[model samples]
Target: MDCDVLIVGGGVAGLSLAWRLSPSRSVVLVEAEGSLAYHTSSRSARQMQPSYGPAAIQELTRRSIAMVEGISERLPAPIMVPRAMLTLGTETEVAALVAANANLESLTHSETMERSPDLRPETFEASALDGTAMEVDVPALLEFYRRQAIGTGAMVLTGAPVTAVEVVASEPAGGTDAEGAGAEDLPTRFHVTAGRHSITAGTVVDAAGAWADVVAAQFGARPRGLQPHRRSVAIVSTEHPVDPSGPMVEPADESFYYRPDGTHLLISPCESVPAEPGDAQVVDEDIAELIHRIGEVTTVGITGVERSWTGLRTQPADGLPVVGFDADVPNLFWLAGQGGYGIQTSAALATLAAGLLTGTLPDDDGWLAGALSPQRAGLG
Candidate 1:
């Protein structure tokens, strides 16, 4: 099999790029697993807290909001549902809450709620509502991308784990006189062997999420600071009656967070650890810590946990995703290390990745040098 672009990993990053690129080029995507997003993408808390992170992240997420909301006539289903988020902190943290409110006011005109009678203000020195935050149906999103890619002549092959990459060292057997080769006209090629097939592509995009580093290593590329960490979540069936539509709550100190999920509550301890990519299990200690946070955050009934699981949150040393062409490796592109914001940041990053691959990337996104450049992180 062969294509103009071959994308590895079927998470939001890969599928989003595939959907974008396949419309203009012959693209093929491969996923190691039989199904798409069976890991982190699926395990994400799926909340779009717009003003909850760094300034760069806020910019990237704001850029993605238009896409996740699904451009008119683009998706069959609505991928984004507006839901408010609140940050509650102790009296000592009131100043930070005020600062957050100021930032959000400048960035967007979304609603703001300073106090919620439903919450205890005595324990919380400050609290603010994020009107711009939204909830995303990640599964629906994955399917949406899949449909877009397949509908537009792109091929998606599942259970296709890339084992080895064959970089065309010399001029490809059928070296082409591609335009703008200048004095260097070496035909660039990547032969990736995955499952029972050897697929060649003019360009290879590594969107393999937590395993992106491993994929890079296969191409003789040393990973710079790719670090995959463990994040655990649980849904507890509290007997106490709580507002099903209540605001998603985050600790003022950025500790644990909980959101109203239907009749139950989805909670996270916000814990992270250096680990590899895989379907992680909920550790007992992590579970205990979460329970503690739950008690501290709300007066809801202390009920049993309905379900629990863990996922990988990959981040570079500087804590941002890599989303540009490789500095040294010919014909290879990168779109990985999205941390927990991959879902929220996918569309923007996908657009940027596509732009880079097509050689049509804009000049002044400031993204080329910071988070996107593999060389900037010493990964090249």
Candidate 2:
């Protein structure tokens, strides 16, 4: 098979990009799993916080909110639901809290207690509320993008893992001679093999999430030192009647967080341990650490762990996503390393990437385009 673009991952980033480009490009998405979003994309915290993560990510997320909201309108069900954010802090964390929120206001222990009754007031000296955060319907969002891409004639293949790629460079188009090629310059092509299927495309995209660098190496591109970090979450029964409308509660320093997940509360240690890329399972020790940390700030008691799971947050050294063409590989794009902020930033990041590929990005997106370029990571 042949296409204009061959996307190597079916996660939100890859799916969203394919959807955006398929209107004018022959796009084909190949997933290593039996189904789409079987990894980090499905195992997310499922929250959309515009002010979260590094500066570059924040920019992309801020730009994505409008796009996400717009897409939500077209979906049969609501994709975004309002949910405030509350960060409990001590005096030592005042500077960090202030830096994170310019308009942060001090919440007295009494006021904080009133907002989230489960929090142990004595453990916190101050608190701030971010009213703009929301809970994202990840399943619906992913489905929307998938349906849009397929409707636009993009082919999606699951359980077909790309194992090899060969880049072929030849003479310019429509200029050839018997002895030697005329022009002697042309764009490269990628021949990819996935399972029993073989595909050729003018451009290839490495959006394999945790396996991004591994995919890069298959096409003779140097790895960008992308590291996959394991993050675990535990869903436990709530001892008290937790408010479903309650804001997501965490320490101002973000050591751990616990939020209402139906009648149960989902708590996490916010741990990021380096690991190999594969199916991730929850660690008992990590869950114990999460419980210990939550006990430090909340009065809730975890009687039982209903369920637990783990996901990989692949991050580069700078903690920003790499989203441009590889500096060394011709026609190969870099669209991985989104960390934990992939879902919230998918819309804007997709648009930005497609714009870069088509050379039609607006003047307003120049900063983000440059910041996420492969050159910023010293690959240029």
Candidate 3:
């Protein structure tokens, strides 16, 4: 089969971009897993906090807020629920927290206690709340993207593991008089093979999460030194009753974090250690550390263990998403290295990436283009 674009990976990044590009281009998306979002996309924190992440990610997420808020019109179900976020800091970290984000409203200890009585008042010397934060309906959002892409004539292949990507300088069989190029002289095209299916496309987008560099290498593109960090989360029952509606809580330094998950609490050690990309598993040491850290910030006691899991957060060397075309490989676009902010920034990033791919991006978007460029990280 032939398409104008072939997207590698069926995570939120690839699905959303296919949704955005399908109306104007013949698109085909392939996922290695049996279903969409079997990895990081499904294992996200599911919070829409534009304030979290790097400068470019912050800009993308901030812009995505509008799209997320208005997404109900496009999807069959709502994708967000109102939830507040509190970033707690010690006395020494107050100034740094405020400097890092001017939007963080300084809250008194009394106010913090009133907002979340479960937190140990003495352990937190400063508190700030971002009222705009919300719990994202990640599954619903992924479903919407998948459905829309298919509905718009894009082929989405799940359980289709891409085994090879052949990139070679080849001309279109027909001469392109507009480019003054003969049938023998044109740029390259990508021949992608997934399972028993083969697709030829003028462009290919890498959105393979932790396996992004692997995908690039398969296609003869330079690997960007992409690193996958293991993040573990645990769910445990608390001895003390917690308000189900309370704001999500975390230390300003992010040593550890816990949020009410129905009657229980979901906690994370805030760990991001480098790991090989694959199905991630929770380690006993990480869970033990999480329980110990929770005791430091909260008065609640863990009564019983419930469950735990781990996921990979892929970050490029420079720690920003690598978007835009490969500077060295013609027709090779990149949409990887989103780290933990992939879901929150998907709407805006997909729009930006689709626009860049089609050459319709506004000139003023050059700042964003430069920031997310593959060359910026020397991945070219």
Candidate 4:
């Protein structure tokens, strides 16, 4: 098959980009798994914390939240629901958080207990509340992107693991053939073999979550030293009745986090252990540690784990996403190394990527463009 763009991952990043680009370009998205978003995207904590991540990521997340809210009325269900994030910590930690986020409300011990009575009073000296946080309906958002992309003419293929990528032709410096052919007659740049399908396209995007670097190497592009870290989460039933309206609880130190999930609680150790690219497994020890930590800080006893899972959050050396075209490989673009911020920043990243691909990005956004550039200094 021939296309203008070939996206080599069907996670939120690839799907969102396909949705944005399919209106003006012939796009083909291929996923190795039998289903889209079968990895990190599906295993997310499903919360959009605007204050989270680095400055660049926070800006992208804010942009993405607005975009999602704009489309909420059209979706089958609301994509975001108000869920304040209550961060518990010592007085020093709370002070630091207050200094960093202007919107965060510093909470005294009494105020913290008023918001979440389950928290142990003596464990934390103070806390902060970010009322802007929201619980994201990840499935709804993913389906919206997938349906929009397919509806607009993008072909999405599942179980199509790419086996080989060959550079069919070198792009000229001026971005056309030496003969100066018309746009419709431009030379193909990549020939890709994935499972039972063969594809040729003018551009290739590497959005493979944990295997992003592996995919880049397959295309003869330099690996960006992306590291995949395993984060484990578990759902456990509480001994007491969980308050559905209670805020999501997390420590300022980020050792762990927990939020109400129906009658149970969704909890994570917030661990970032380096891992290889593959399906991650939950470590019993990690869950044990998480339970112990919760016991020290909360009165809501976890009776037993109802379910547990793990996912890989990929990150570059500097812990920022890699966007824009590859500096060394012509016609190759990167949309990887989003780490844990992928879902929250998908829309903005997709918009930025589409602009970069089509050369229509506003000139005023140069700072952002430079920040996310694949060749930016300190990033592999």
* Top lDDT model: 4
The C-alpha lDDT values of all candidates are 0.77, 0.85, 0.86, 0.91
The true-versus-predicted C-alpha distance at residue 311 of model 1, in Å, is 0.4
Model 3: residues with Cα > 4 Å off, grouped in runs: 73-77, 168-184, 377-380
Please give me the total number of clashing residue pairs in predicted model 3. 0
Give all TM-scores, in the order shown: 0.89, 0.94, 0.94, 0.95
lDDT of 4: 0.91
lDDT of 3 by residue, 51-124 (tens): 68777787888788788778766766677876788988875576666678755677878998999998877787
lDDT of 2 by residue, 97-144 (tens): 666665355677788788898877678887777777778889889998
How many pairs collide in each candidate, listed in order? 0, 0, 0, 0
Q: Assess the local accuracy of residue 315 in candidate 1 as a C-alpha lDDT between 0 and 100.
A: 81
Error of 3 at 193 (Å): 1.1
Candidate with better TM-score, 1 vs 4: 4
Where is model 1 more than 4 Å wrong at Cα?
72-77, 100-118, 169-185, 366-370, 377-380
